[model samples]
Target: MQSVADGSQSSEVPNVLGDFALHLSAQRGLSAHTVRAYTSDLEQLFLFAQGQGVESYAEMELSTLRGWLAEMASRQLSRSTVARRGAAARTFFEWAARTGRIEQDPAARLASPRQHKVLPTVLAVNSAATLMDAARDLAVEGGPADLRVWACVELIYATGARVGEIVDLDVRDVDLDQRSVRVLGKGDRERIVPFGVPAAAALRAWLERGRPALATWSTADALFVGQRGQRWGQRQVRDAVHRLSAIAGVDDVAPHDLRHSAATHLLQGGSDLRTVQEVLGHATLATTQRYTHVSAERLRSSYQLAHPRA
Candidate 1:
């Protein structure tokens, strides 16, 4: 082990950052998945640099960073994945520099890989309604899948929230009297999103008639519980959305599509961009503006359909 100025030690043969990452995760409150990814990414970089006779991160140069990027591209990694790796590297190096382990940050000037600006696809109002209707019918059957499926579809479209946010919701997060649900969005930011009467009705049905039947002693306070009495995860919500979309004749619909549908419909109903931003919990207004484009496209199609003159 080579001791560094920061009172830290690095393996002379390379590849030991995984243990450091676990330490950061277990002690520093980092998410487990994030810790795993960051550790794996950093370990790869360290090994590559070591293969070139560079002992520590401080010995890295701009060319070495670029070479790593080229290696990622050669492996057919997506632009977004490469970009995330770059970010991870930058974060790790910054921490190293701060702790005196590294004298300089090699990733400071590393440009983020340009990602494709793929716009999200959304369902039309009628199509969304059809999906909700299917969910309702399924739930009325009183099966566990039906109850969870109904709530997933209804709440997602109603609040336009990310699936993670919806799954993390507690029973008390919803306010029936106020017609709002409190959501803890990304970065632990809390926002209140209002749901319409239909969504409220669906939620009421699930809470009153459905949830109790599925509730168990170990069931957490989560608003959505699985058949095993665990809280619903993002994967479960995605599967439910996929099934409901198929029933509605839209097999490709995703959880995010409901978010798009909400924003588009809100704009079409004359809501302003700022209001949409707040409702969607967007940190920037620029993100909410995309819905305006979707709304404009819908308006053009409507105009073409109803126009008397050719």
Candidate 2:
């Protein structure tokens, strides 16, 4: 971790940040992506502090943290990005205080802006059906790549797993007999998410027909593989979803839209919020509640179309 601060700033800042990053990855089990994000946020904060002539963590104050946030706002950063940065500051300061690196936690009083609750975009029932039909048709073309794409979309829609989790899956993680997949989600939490029979059939076809065509000794036991017979990447999965959606005449949809559609469809079909949360591997019920809003909006639209009163 190189110092983002100026020459006048304390070198200890970078050292402490390096230690914190290590702790997050080794002890707290945070994913590499999360650790990188937190470290980046803290580096920006340190650079801001250097500009303010605050050379050490011990000199940090609530007002200084607030000024940094105000600077972010001035730069027109998104609410989610500012909020995440605030959270990163809070967590870092808390750790510093607990570990006796700092005399007090300046960010203890810091507050993150409330994240706006925007409903995720989901495919309508007809559109989702069309997209899956397109993928099925592609699979019927008998190409290894087409079969893999069909299986990926089927598993995503069937289980609502994140693209990262889907790509991380190994052959041992999928249980065809149980119709479930073992997902390793954020914070390294593991959960078993169930898929429907359609997904099972697609998965079986890919395993029997598609994967063998691509697989090599170097492919190991990954459930999904790329054209080069290595583990599938999230970007490739997302691109495949986008391309398939466009072919189905539903443009601008991503892999996550399939997840959102799965959750919303489940709610519309009478699945409870808690069950959806568990299936989606959401840490909080509040995170899962967003799908309820999507379901309600769809119901209202349907009612408006069918009711006698205008």
Candidate 3:
């Protein structure tokens, strides 16, 4: 409803946005998800700019950027989503300036609201054990399918690897003898994550008894294969996790929750922050620090439940 620009100043907005997207992918090597998210936010900005009568990336002043954010806030958007949009704007303008698409970065001094921090959801230690126990129970009573499910859940929680990384795994990525698994993380970064004996044993059983029945010529390298012998999909892994939860009588959780639980459990077990960061393949130590908070919260909960004094 606000009109900051009265006339069409530039029509190169779409073209510059395309170039920005290419830079994000080819030059920056950001993940597809990250690239898409950034592009989506920019697209919304372009729409807002169109309504404001601003025409080009170079013409977008700090007021234009602030106005765009203010508009989103007026719409009552979540702070995290709004914060992400602010980040996208900063990234776009910086790239535009660096690549000479724009004379200067308009978002240089733009200040966006910080995202509201929410604690990650994690399972308690006993609940995690119950889930694994249920997975094992199913594997014992059932065939290759159950064994594969057991192995998938064990490996996910054990390594704190993202489901995308887990589904992308190759048979060669695992080393049973050394108890370590090579996880290719975001930005194509690779790291070795060690698992406990429980995970190793489950992996061994799946590799020997389960994967053989599912592997085909095309899926020979795939560590976890689907029913028709293609590489396992993330959806399939999620389904397995849900099924395990129902059977285990624990609260339902997704694969990422398992990752959160694993990180928290490692911290509770006395693993240092750096070691947990390496295991999770986080780009920053700050991301890994959240698990320490989860552990502290649990410690407080335990003390409150046990202590008699007010």
Who is ahead in TM-score, 1 or 3?
Answer: 3
Local error of candidate 1 at residue 220 (angstroms): 4.1
- lDDT score for candidate 3 against the true structure: 0.88
lDDT score, candidate 2, position 224: 96
* Estimated TM-score for each candidate: 0.83, 0.93, 0.92
- Candidate 1 has its poorest 10 consecutive residues by lDDT at 1-10
Ten residues in sequence with the least summed lDDT for candidate 2? 1-10
Best to worst by lDDT, what's the order? 2, 3, 1
Name the lDDT of candidate 1: 0.80
**Residue 223 displacement in candidate 2 (angstroms):** 1.2
Residue pairs of candidate 1 with colliding backbone atoms: none
Each model's lDDT comes to 0.80, 0.90, 0.88
lDDT of 2: 0.90
Q: Write the per-residue lDDT of candidate 2 for residues 57-94, one digit (tens) a residue.
A: 67889999999999999999999999999999999999
How many clashing pairs in candidate 1?
A: 0
Writing each residue's lDDT as its tens digit, candidate 1 over 226-264 gives: 877788789988887887788777646889889888889
Off by over 4 Å in 2: 1-11, 303-310
Please give the RMSD to the true structure for each candidate, in Å: 4.7, 2.2, 3.6
